[model samples]
Target: MSSEVDKGSSTQRKEGESKRSKPILTRSVSQLAVAEAQHLVLWKKPLSTIYHLVQYMADNFVYLYSEIVRNKIFVFCGIIILIGSYFLDNIEGPHQALFDAVKKNGYWMSYWTFLGFLSSFGFGTGLHTFLLYLGPHIAHVTLAAWTCKSLDFPEPPYPDTIICPTQESAESVVSFWTIFNKVSVEAICWGAGTAIGELPPYFMARTARRSGENLEEEEQSSAKKKVQELVTRFGFFGILLCASIPNPLFDLAGITCGYFLIPFSTFFSATLVGKAGIKMAMQTSFIIIVFTESYLKMVIRLIAGIPKFGAILEPYITDYFEQQRIKLKLGQDSNDGGLVSFLLTCLVTGMIMYFVISTINSLAQQHLIQELKKQSKSESKKDK
Candidate 1:
């Protein structure tokens, strides 16, 4: 009896060791990865469902003009309506004339409002990209763990010292495209389309607020406001068109193009061709125009990076009241030291600018989140 009990205990110990030995590597998805995955989820979801989600997203993200749709309509309607307005501006010219007339008549307030609307339109739809940091890490952990589980699917001793073949092996071409190559791009394309669809009108409204428009009839001409009614319908169509394509790809291409040189010059032409096919199928001409016309945009962007901007101001810096001018590189001199006061001056100025910009951005983000919370509460009350 003693021998049998001892044998069972030893077997149980070996099984426990086997289970504990399984995990050889642990990893976490970066915020960028999460953002990419979410875009994939959005694109994979049904059109109607995505439309509803956009509606929920937009209301929380923007101070969309009360002048626009009063109904609890889908968010994409705004994008559709914007596109229609663009065409209307092209053909009927009613909306364009009204806008021009407003500007001519010293509607500087309206003009500024229009610019603001353009800047923040897609902000609502893209706000969800924050899910990169805001969401539960559980989903990410699960994906990592699921991959680890599949490490043994080919049957393995999965040696402890050996990096498992599953971890080291080249992922299939499809996986490579979808995982590393596509994620960064998906975020950019989706974000840009969201911006294009959502920004113009909301920006207009916000600009009015920013410019201190306190009166109701300040710019409302009864005949002119009829164009806004069409704006809602057309905006929805535009958003639908944007949402259909891999919107993230457009942005990804632009940004990555700015930062990187590899596989881009070769792949970019092909990418544009793919995007052209996509936009035409969706009947969104704006996208085709964007990718086709923006060849110099990235080179321009590379020139305008933050570090490059710092370098631009370096030449103007001159050392004061000295026998010989001191040439100081960045971070080489302490501000209190006298040898390179000019460099110190520039450094201090740059630091101040960075702080002020960062603070304002933080405030903007906080304001946005607060606005979203208020909207959510209002929506819930209305639903009840």
Candidate 2:
């Protein structure tokens, strides 16, 4: 369905004209010729940032594949180890807890509950990345998202669901890769380190651009700036604290303290201890949910007609997306950007991360309301 634009259409110049002028592709003449060519050419863009990167690497494979790997082998190996860390992410007990939360509380209630869960994540990761890395490296992913949006490419992740930063292999981010690998090495050497020290606890902070929230709001330059500054001040010692605190209490204390204070300072300080703990929780929960027997029990309770309390979950999740949409200042909200329609598109595109929200809507918002009617009717009949 996607096509590359042919240079001939936009450029009055032909590739032939350029090749003829300078057969030595390395010469300045070739460079000028190429620039003239792109200026004149009407070409379709690539699908995404990652797509653009992979394409760039593909275009220069002979130069990059070996020497770059050699120069950066230590970092590469550490990144390799980080990728391996995904295997440790399951939490059978927590996974069961999630299921139990869903079943006993109702899918909807559990859904509403995740807002506190997600926002709390932002607090910590912002701190961890800023303090330890001193780079607004989080953009590594957002930039990828922007790149993907520009090109329309799907995410090119490996089969393992553990997220590796999209730009780990980017030609420009060599230092970032090195730093990230350093952290991964530390995690490995120390162990998941008291639940807070665990790397998997947090999922990469979710982006709201996907939900069609305000593009302007989502595009705010300050979010990255705040996180980066926090890093500058605290360094990783600040990070160690972030990697240790529980997210809920951390956020609870933060938001309460923050209402009278500025959002950035509140968020930045909260982040100091928030990022690592938040990520660890998610990673731990994800692992537990997928593997444990308690998971089975949680599922069983739902099937057996237990009244789950998910009344506010759908709206909560939706609001969470909206909140990020506003905070990050993306394109438009669900109301303006045809977000509901676009969300449907995501559903079709196989972004399963949103399924929980979807289930909440279908079951708790619509289905459960009807299910309750059925239960009421059966009860009345038995009473008669």
Candidate 3:
């Protein structure tokens, strides 16, 4: 009887141990699985999947054509053009007269220039804005280049002359200064215009309140006061940073200031300083590149005359010149003279940050609600 009792006790002890160890073993396996899943999801799998997806899209002709035709208005406009061309060909006499009119007195050029100016004003008014959506630096560079090309300025200042002007090089200095000032001032003026854009919406809101419209006065006032306080605290630095940075958010800042009745002169001064400073920096960089070509090429030639490192460096030096040419062209036409790509990148990153923050806040709110519900249920159960 004693032996049988001891055997039963040992069996019970073994069963208890197995029960405790099962959870540990299961938990360890689960943790390992979770970690492996996370590693696969985080980078390796997602990157490979994205790469394959892009490769597939690039290879699909139908998909590519569909994507191109997705712009309905543009496609419709193309169709209209085709139909219009057919009709015009049938009425060549009238079409010819219209064509001649466009050709005469540089009418076509004047028409396009007028349209450009109109578009610039219409589209560029907002807080974080560019002239016709062309970045400020690119717009300035293109304008400067066009002005120089059109006017045929005598020995129009290249970067080299601008950077290293001497007492004897008065012509180059003057030309450089003139172009720089022109571009810089234009940028400043555009900045001011954007600041002005922030005004109308705020005024309209104020007007609605005054007129006893449906707007909630207390909420509007509270929000406005909060913004005003923040702006007042930051003051000049805030304005200057917004103006200097190439982003659409600047317009909103300008509008806030206007809504709060910040002094126009003060606002203009900050904007002018910020915008002009950025433009001047860009102009200086362009001049420096030109200077480098003239001075660096001479140094490179001297080095090439040397025996050992010259051979290796020659190909590199040639490649550098080639890259500079491409850079100069791309800088003028795309991505705001390539000087302000960082600003554009910042704007995009900022937008993504805002999106992520908003999403996190939403998730946090949901979690809090769930926790509150759980707490209430526990409290009810305890009462029962």
Best by lDDT: 3
Candidate 2 lDDT over residue span 1-384, tens digit each: 123354545464575676666334223333343343232211333233234344434545765667677779777888887675444334354566555544543443333223223332333322122212212122223322232222122233311111333233343332333323423322221222222222112211112122321111112255444543443456444434543543333332332222223334434434433443454334333433422334534544444453454433344434543443343333222344345445645554553334333322222222222333346447657987
Candidates ranked, most accurate by lDDT first? 3, 1, 2
> What TM-score would candidate 2 get against the native?
0.22
Worst 10 residues of 3 by lDDT: 159-168
Model 1, 1-384: lDDT tens per residue? 999999999999998886665321101112222233333322254453344445545654664555345544755687788897667666764477786665453443333233322222332332322222111121222222223322222222211111113333344332222322212233334334333434233333445445543212223455334333332334333223333454442332232222222233333333333332353233222222222213223433444454856446333322221111121111122345344455545665665465444433433443343344446447657987
RMSD of 2: 28.2
Candidate 2 local Cα displacement, residue 249, angstroms:
20
* Candidate 3 error regions (>4 Å): 1-170, 173-179, 205-229, 263-269, 276-384
Q: Report lDDT (CA) for all predictions.
A: 0.36, 0.35, 0.48
Instruction: Write down the TM-score for model 3.
Output: 0.30
Candidate 1 lDDT for residue 194: 37
* Global lDDT of model 2: 0.35
Which sections of candidate 1 miss by over 4 Å?
1-167, 170-176, 179-235, 239-384
1 versus 2: better TM-score goes to: 2
